[model samples]
Target: MASKESDAVRRHWATNRKAAEENRQDGDQELADHRWAELTTEPADVDYLAVPGRRAQWIVPHGAAADRALLCLHGGGFVGGSQYSHRKLFAHLARAVGVRALVFDYPLAPDHPHPAQVDDAVDTYRWLLDQGIAPEHILFTGDSAGGGLTITTQLRARSVGLPLPAGAMPFSPWVDFEATGASYDENRDRDAFFHRDLVRGLAWIFLGPDGSPRDPFVNPLYGDLTGLGPIYIQVGGDEVLLDDAQQLAAGAEKAGVEVELDVFPEMQHTFQMAAGRAPEADDAIRRMGRFARRVLELETR
Candidate 1:
């Protein structure tokens, strides 16, 4: 049986689904920002710092390895999300992995559009590299749309001859811009948010008037996966995006890129947001930390 705390994610979405939709309709991001931050319990022994020359912040857990970094892309459907909203969540993961995290805000869609997010992501990555962090010591990670960026950023960076990170971890990634996944239908009743209509609307805004939903950088499921680092994906079993995780893993493996997929039964989208307050979320972070350590070639024993 799942722990009672597991239902917290489910309740969070179900309770806020209406308000979030209303916020979108009302053109307000403040509520969504506050709501997103409220999901995670503040982790102890983690310090936050502003990143110079960027709309980014560092989540430095006490005694974390100075040489390793977790580059996080905040997720809000490419339309919302920020460093402040995701700091606690990143802090929990950084603490678990024994490394520091850097989370940043990319321009939102319906205003900035495609390639803007990817450009910012690639730039942030390049900035990390410039900061003297070795590619082998950094891991690209994100949740939701940012999860999609975990793969797309590498594609964008590679096009410009940038070195790939050691690995990537995408939490409840929304990779299928086309929203053609069968899980959308299968998990419709189970998912409180993430209906196809909602995703289509967001994609339309994100892709803009000329953007192609099938474009490699916009929808990474259709992107080339060869030569990229290993991918670790985690999604809820009840999420409408379950197939997104499965499809991404398959694509990675087919291209000879290492992949690991974990579907947490009965959990909601991005359930890891409940870190520090839920056993399920804590377990997921631990698994992700282990994977990060192994791929980064850090001592795991």
Candidate 2:
């Protein structure tokens, strides 16, 4: 049985879903983005700074560890989300994990596609390295398409001989560009914000004319899973992307990588967006924080 708060969240998102559908029909991406951004609670105590060489914001939570960092990617289906929209959520996660988080914007699709997003992610990771943050002290995380980039960026980093981060946390990652996951249909009616058509449309825009859906950089589920560090994935049981998390966990485990996947029942996609307002979201962030602490070996204060 779902908690009362969870049920309330479901109702709220159902309303949001209707609005999103109407917004889409009206060709209002900006309004849809604004509506989604309204779900997050901004942190009043966190310091926001601009990265010198990248289009990124550094969200430094009070009392956070200066030596540890989280490279956070915001999810907007590779088209809409930005650092401002996700900065609060990233700040909450970073505060919980006792680290600063860098949330950056990359070129979105239909204008700049596939390789551009990956390139920006790789460049940001390199910038963090150059800032003297050790690879082992850093973690990567994001939601939706940004979640997928958490993995792809690691792959990109490895291709260029950059050291891998200590761990990753991908919340409701949109990893299957082919949309072959059974959850797409199984949870179709259960999920509020996503439908097959919307996902397909986003994929087309993000992949452009030259990109392949199966390219590991485009979809990390198809990438080689060997040699990556620990990964913790969280997905809503009601989300259409549930199978993406399941498959990625299975594939990573098969390749001898440490992986943990949590499926929250009766939750919507990226429910972590409701952080600070929902118990489930808070629990999920705490779990990720615990995982980050274990991987980074940060002693409890």
Q: Which candidate is the best by TM-score?
A: 1
Clashing residue pairs, backbone N/CA/C < 3 A, model 2: none
Segments in model 2 whose C-alpha atoms lie over 4 Å from true places: 4-33
Q: What C-alpha RMSD separates each model from the true structure?
A: 1.5, 2.1
- Stretches off by above 4 angstroms in model 1 are 20-28
- Candidate 2 lDDT over 164-271, as tens digits, reads 999799989988888888898999999876888878888999999988999998887678889999999999999998998998889889988999999998888888
- Tens digit per residue, CA lDDT, model 1, 228-264: 8888999999999999999999999999999999999
Clashing pairs in 1: none
lDDT of each: 0.89, 0.87
> How do the predictions measure up, each by TM-score?
0.96, 0.93
Error of 1 at 293 (Å): 0.8
